[model samples]
Target: MAQNVTRAGKSRTDFRDAIQPFLAPSLREKCATVLAGSVPGLEEIRIRCGRPLMAIGGNGDFFITPQGTISQSPAQAYLPDREDLDRSLQLLGQGSAYALEEQLRSGYITLPGGHRVGLCGKTLVESGRVMRLINISGLNYRLARAIKGLADPITRYIVVGGKPAHTLIVSPPRAGKTTLLRDLVRQFSVGIAELGFPGVKVGLVDERSEVAACYGGVPQMDVGFRTDVLDSCPKAEGILMLIRSMSPQVIATDELGGRKDIEAVEELISAGASLFTTAHGSDPEDLRGRPGLAALMEWKVFERYIFLGRSLGIGTVEKLTDRNLGSLINDKFVLRPRPGSGD
Candidate 1:
């Protein structure tokens, strides 16, 4: 099984183990060898029918050769056959694709260890809605690793005056927004005792099963000691439900967009619950162009706006700003690491 240590210093899981079951036999063997060998910073393992097998790590993307070494040329990589796709579907479905039709329609499946396999294929549409993906062509097994205590540097800003601020984390895709958000959730769940912040009830709306990465109704990740998660639920609906029933001091979710989402955020704020969520963007000005986000900014829904990017590393804090769009901190700020935050 996967083994990961939580931000609260608890053991959880590893991505390679979680991804093993979904890989075809030959590819699985290759990946196992790669993992067993020293492939520093290995992250994603890619499989495509007509293309070479690829592996992505901290250095960059490269093709995986038959000898388990990084291929300098794509031509040196192995091309997975059609049977590999069939086997992958069956394994990912745990025997039958019919069992996971709903998740397939969403273009991805959330595996047990919070690992996600994104699929690409011809879209089957019925009555203007996606039915499923047929003739599957490609799969990207994106690795999910939680860097425990990554959020410690920003805890002081989040927990202000013994209460969590309405925070909105902004970043472009793959900028570690989700990872940062997850760590923040864990910190909120356990609270920073050194900072005089007590653990409060946090309701997490994991719309894509990405936040808490719950498997079979239980979180594979440690969000905190006091966190209630609504997995794979619609953002707007989940937000309302969490507020009505969970009595959370803070409501956290991922990828906020759409009118209903904005309405839900307003409702939660009205109900006296602090909000924590993320959006896709480059910087603060990028948010102004997006309609739903622009509305949130206009309403001043969030008290703090944190901008994350890949400046120094994946989870680098690019900028920190207030609700009024005033700058607060930059990447060079001297942030002391907290206990258990892996200084």
Candidate 2:
């Protein structure tokens, strides 16, 4: 916390100016984590209040300092220079935002789950082509991870013959579904012989670095030695690409929607790759009732759907539903439970 050199009085304004929308105390800890190169499971940096902890690392090597000190490298700080912006623009022009993102991640960068940075700029499209973007502004450095046992909450519900079923995890906003998915990836990745499946070959479609955070063609997170991730590719294209090349036993992704993505899900399942995904919804009905997910429900694309929520400020397993079982929660229509069919 003392890392903030600014004092009270006029220094408060300077602190506000320098600080990136978070308190100095938390920033110091985040800064330290970023410098460390690898942040452990489920860490993230967000904008305003809410999650207490803020954003984190990308799938690239983090530097605390661009220029090395007599004892260490320079600490990570925001880069708003036009020279850096120029480089970003040039790289982006070639549809190489991933490369540009890697360049910006030189030092003191945050990396939770080995996740990479989220960049923003003006769109550069021409005649149905997304050429690149210009005027880079605002950076969202993400932490990547493969936290073992993150799926423990639903560990009891997901197993089918000792292996987690073809599962769909659902949550709203930031209820930790991706975080939970990240955990499942780790669990599946474990090189276990007795887990029924020996050395599961897992494929992670991390278009947004949700699992297997990758930076510059290298994985920043340990998503299991058996895992292969397609970072930054469109979800549908990435799925097709994985099936074509990776020969995966399981395919994992975050935030599913769109006809193309659903089609890919169907295609993969047809080939025998179990699909795991998350979407922004609170319950199974909320997901099933949605126009997009309704088709998947009709096709029974997912064997299980895990609903997540925060209970008393801690993440909780709110519900789990199957096509036959209907609502796993005691009360589906209301938050409080009522007399149920389970007796």
Question: Which candidate has the highest TM-score of all?
Answer: 1
List model 2 lDDT by residue over 1-343, tens digit each: 0111111111223322323232233244444434332332223433222112233322212333222211122234332344443443343334454654433333122232243445555666669765654455544443332334445445555557765578888777656677678667766777433345455788899877556656456765556778888876788999999999999988998988888898898889887888888888876667777666788887777778777776533246677787553666563221111122001
lDDT, residue 118, model 2: 51
**Superposition error at 245 for model 2 (Å):** 3.1
Q: How many steric overlaps are in each model, in order?
A: 6, 27
Model 2 worst lDDT window (10 residues): 1-10
Candidate 2 segments whose C-alpha is farther than 4 A from its true place = 1-115, 128-130, 191-197, 325-343
lDDT, candidate 1, 198-251, per-residue tens: 889999999899888877879877788899999989999999999999999999
Segments in model 1 whose C-alpha atoms lie over 4 Å from true places = 1-13, 333-339
* Model 1 pairs in collision: 2-13, 2-14, 3-13, 3-14, 4-12, 4-13
